[model samples]
Target: MRYNKEDLIEWIIRERQPGGQMFERFTERARKVIVQAQEEARKLNQNYIGTEHLLLGLI
Candidate 1:
């Protein structure tokens, strides 16, 4: 399975277990991580954003 930006966003939201309208708060951090991951991949000249790239961003 491919882990794209949307998938990551959905995963984060799902994992948050947010209450009521609090889910929205997770969006910003999720987006930031996505953007940073993309940038890291770009800097490394990666053609696809894979799970390894996402893990790299986490570090």
Candidate 2:
């Protein structure tokens, strides 16, 4: 199966685990950073988010 950018982003945002709801408390800029991290992971064909991806997103 293939996941598009929007799908991946949504999955990341809607993660149904502990701290999932923490996303709701994030500032708009922080949320954008998460989205960008997901995008960076996708670009690298990675299925998981990592510090490097988050750093790239921040950049």
Tell me the number of clashing residue pairs for each predicted model: 0, 0
Displacement of residue 33 (Cα, Å) in model 2 is: 0.5
Scored by CA lDDT, what does every candidate get?
A: 0.67, 0.82
Q: Choose the strongest candidate by lDDT.
A: 2
Worst window of 10 by summed lDDT in candidate 1: 15-24
Question: What would the TM-score be for candidate 2 when compared with the true structure?
Answer: 0.62
For candidate 1, give the lDDT of residue 54: 73
Show model 2 residue runs off by greater than 4 Å: 1-22
Give lDDT: candidate 1, residue 27. 69
Q: What are the runs in model 1 whose C-alpha is more than 4 Å off?
A: 1-26
lDDT of 2 by residue, 1-59 (tens): 88799988887877844236667898878888888888899899998989999899899
